[model samples]
Target: MSNFTYRKDHIPKGTACNRRPGFAMKPTTITIHNTANEKSSAANERAWLTNPSNKVQASYHIVIDEREAIECIPLNENAWHAGDGSGSTSGNRTSIGIEICESGNYTKTIDNAVMLVAQMLMERGWGVDRLRRHWDWSGKICPRLMYDGGTWSKWYAFKAAVQGRLNELKKEGVASVSDKVTVKAYGKQIKDGKLIDGTVYVPLRAVAEARGDQVSWDNNTKTATIYK
Candidate 1:
């Protein structure tokens, strides 16, 4: 199970007298935005979208805060997030929008958004190259913290963090690698080893068992013990 939490409070779908028809979207990119309203919380964003009295036609797929995330719209459906109109180039029609809440610690909020974006990319089999700032599709200065200054260092840093997290996730699923090297124990060949950075590494468990030795680990001491 994911450590992240999602609150599903979807915006009204389908065409109504006052609302636009819900259209299917194949998200090729993940669009990022900052609420701009520092006074608003993630809950506030969700509530505003759900409130019928609020005439704002804007909606997004998710709203992230320092503590949690809230799903405001379905990923497969279009949401009125990007300033672009209803067209092929519109971000709403081709991307998933994530709004970062600015209520709490700004750095922590950005960290939460990075994790959510990384998780989404992993699930969709997409790469960090698919990430985009709100300004990418439109000229609006959204996610001001990332794009306000002439230098885009903050935005670049955020993308780097997301990429790093994705790499970590991918490494977790990789079990082992085979390389050309020799491994020996007690003048007997136990198993082949791999040379990495000029250092030879053998499969510890395989070599230990092949030598008729039992291996035990001490979690507290972070050490491994081998006994005959």
Candidate 2:
């Protein structure tokens, strides 16, 4: 999934920000946001959300910095990040919120968020069309870096970056060899094949059969003959 490090120091479930129980989220979209506090890191933001004295009533699924991503809330649970209130808005019930840390290098922060979103999309079988900015849910310019300057070109560029990362993951295939190798003959998929040392080795009989060719095994010659 892009080999990025993920920290799972989740905020306490009893916190005021995430006190709702039995509320689950079926993530249909990925919401992008900016922490806005440039001096705070991802860990700092997570701590702030969990602090009893801080009653911000806000929490996000993940906070991404330039170096790593820290998951502050469970993806299956709702986080009050969309600012759409307690309504049944898509952002509150059907979307995963990711806040990009404003500290450190701006480009690196965005790149990290892009990779995280791309990986999530690939795992969930989602397309770039499912990506959304925080402003889409409410009139708030939440992801200020992306929605700032009154120009939408940055948002489009972010989507493009996510799409590019997704394409790369598809081409690279899964991490396991079994998922990375695919064999096809004459436009038909064949299962008797494996990836070995970056090369795909397929059974002769399987390939021949997939191509509608007859395969005969010669015991004496210790060979297989294909009749096309």
Among the numbered candidates, top TM-score falls to 2
Q: Residue by residue across 1-228, what tens digits does model 2's lDDT show?
A: 334467677777577755434367677898999898988888888888867798676778889887888877777778888878766665877788899999988788888777888777887678999988889998788688776577867889999999998899899773231223568789998776775322477888888888899899899989889997
Question: Residues 93-119, candidate 1, lDDT per residue (tens digit)?
Answer: 988899998887877787777777877
* Per-residue lDDT value at 180 in model 1: 59
Point out the worst 10-residue segment of candidate 2 by lDDT.
173-182
Say which candidate scores most in lDDT: 2
lDDT of each: 0.76, 0.78
The alpha-carbon lDDT assigned to residue 81 of candidate 2 equals 83
Candidate 2 global TM-score: 0.73
Report the CA-based lDDT of candidate 2 relative to the real structure: 0.78
Q: 48 in model 1: Cα distance from truth in Å?
A: 0.6
